[model samples]
Target: MVYPKTGSLIVRDGREMTYTHIQANQTPSRSVCFFFPGASYSFDRPYLYYSTMLFLSKQIDLVHVNAAYGKDIPDFETSSFAKRSAWISEDVKTVVFQVLDQQEYEHVFFLGKSLGTVPIACSLLKEPRFSRSSAILLTPLLREELVVADLLALEQNVFLVSGTADPHYHQPTLERIITSKPNIHRYLPQNAKHSLDIGLQVDLSLQVLQSIMDELGCFLDKSLDI
Candidate 1:
C-alpha cells in the first residue's frame, strides 16, 4: 500500500528543498523518522516508505527521502562513491537539517537502508545541534570510515536494526558491533536476505516491519505520548 505522502517546502538561500513525508494519522507523534532508500531510487515499496509505514505504523512520523530526486541520474554511477557520499553529506544532509530545523518536530529518528545508512549517521555525528535524534539502519553498510563503529557515541539515543540473512551485513561482526554499542538495539530476522527481502521466507515484508517495530518500540511509545 502507498503511504499518505505530503510534501514540506524548505526555502533557504533562495533555493527550494522539499522532502516528501507521510504522517501517521492514528496517533500524534513527537518523533519523525527519515527513511532512506538503498543505492537506486527506491521510491517504490519494500524499501523506503512502505516498509516503514507497514512496520512503524502510527508509532512515529515517516519521511521518505529521495536521494536521486533532483540529481542527474546519468552521472550517478560514474561518480565515485566518495563524491556521492559527499553530495549526500553536504547537499542532501544540509537540506534535511534545514527543513527539520525550520520547524519543530518532537524527537527525530534518522533511519536508512543500505547505502543511505552512512550519510545520516555521519551527518548526525558531525552536527552537535542534532542531539535530539536517533538512527535505525537496515542491512547496514559495513566498514565505512565515517560510520564504522562509534555510532552509539553520536547520540544519546541510537538504534541499529539489521537482518542475519542480509548479504551485506556480517552476522558475526554484528555481534562485535553490538557488544560495544549499549545504546543500539540490533534485531536480526531468521533467514532474512537484504532490505525488504530480509530473508528467503513467507511474508518477508511483514517480518521486516515487525523487526523495525521491535527495535524502535521506544520511539514508537514516545509517539503514543505525543
Candidate 2:
C-alpha cells in the first residue's frame, strides 16, 4: 500500500525538519491537511494511516510532519512546559508556513494526536491566518491547563476524541470545554485506553476505530460543505 509522496526538508530554529507531502490523485485539491504525530506515534499508526487515506480519498493533499525530540534534542526533555510548548509550536508553524507560502489553498486543516495536539492547541488555533482552518485533535492532553484553555477559546471547527480510561483524559477539563465552546465536537469511548483500544477486546477496538473513521468522515464532509 504505497502512496505517492514527495519527501522534503526544511530548516527551522537551527534544526532540520523533514516531512512527506502526499498529493491526492486525479483532480487538483483545494484543501490541504497537515498531520502532527504524537511523540511515539508515527504516521503509519492506525488512526493516522486511515485518516491519511481518508483525506486523500476526499482529494485533500496531506503533509506528514516527522518530528521527534528527546534523543535528538536533549534539552527538550528537561525544558519547562512553557518552553516545550513554544518549541513544538515553532516547529509546526515553520512547516505549515513554508508549505503554504508555495501555494494557495481554499481550506486548511490540521490533525494531531497526543503530543502533536500541543502545537495545534497552543499556537495554530490562535493564529489569525488559520482562523478559518479546522482541526482534529486525537487523544489530546486534556489534563494540561494550557491545552484545555486554548481548546476552550477555539473559534473554528474542531473534532476532539479521547478515552475516559486514558491518563490524559480529564473529565473536568472536557466538561469546561464542552460548556464553553460549541464549535468543538468531542467523542469519548468508555473503557478505551490511550490508543482508543479496549483491553483484550480486539473486536471492540476495531469497532471503536470504525466509529472514529465514520465520525471523522462526517466531520470532514460537513466542514468542507460537501
Highest lDDT scorer? 2
TM-score of 1: 0.73
Ten contiguous residues minimizing lDDT sum, candidate 1 = 8-17
Local error of candidate 2 at residue 39 (angstroms): 0.3
Over 4 Å off, model 1: 1-18, 23-29, 41-43, 54-59, 69-75, 150-153, 196-200, 203-205, 222-226
Q: Could you tell me the lDDT of residue 177 within candidate 1?
A: 63
Count of backbone collisions within predicted model 1: 6
**TM-score of decoy 2:** 0.95
How well is each residue in 1-226 modelled by candidate 2, as lDDT tens digits? 3345555555555777888877785444799999999988899889999999899888898889887765667788888888899999998788889888876889999999999999998999899998999999999998888887788888999999999899999998888877888899999989889988999999999999999999999999999993
lDDT of 1 by residue, 65-123 (tens): 66552354545557776666665666567657755765567777777777777677766
Q: Provide the lowest-lDDT 10-residue window in model 2.
A: 1-10
Cα displacement (Å) at residue 105, model 1: 1.8
Give the C-alpha miss distance for residue 107 in model 1, angstroms. 1.2
- Residue 27 of model 2 has an lDDT of 46
Candidate 2 achieves a global lDDT of 0.88
What lDDT does each candidate get? 0.61, 0.88
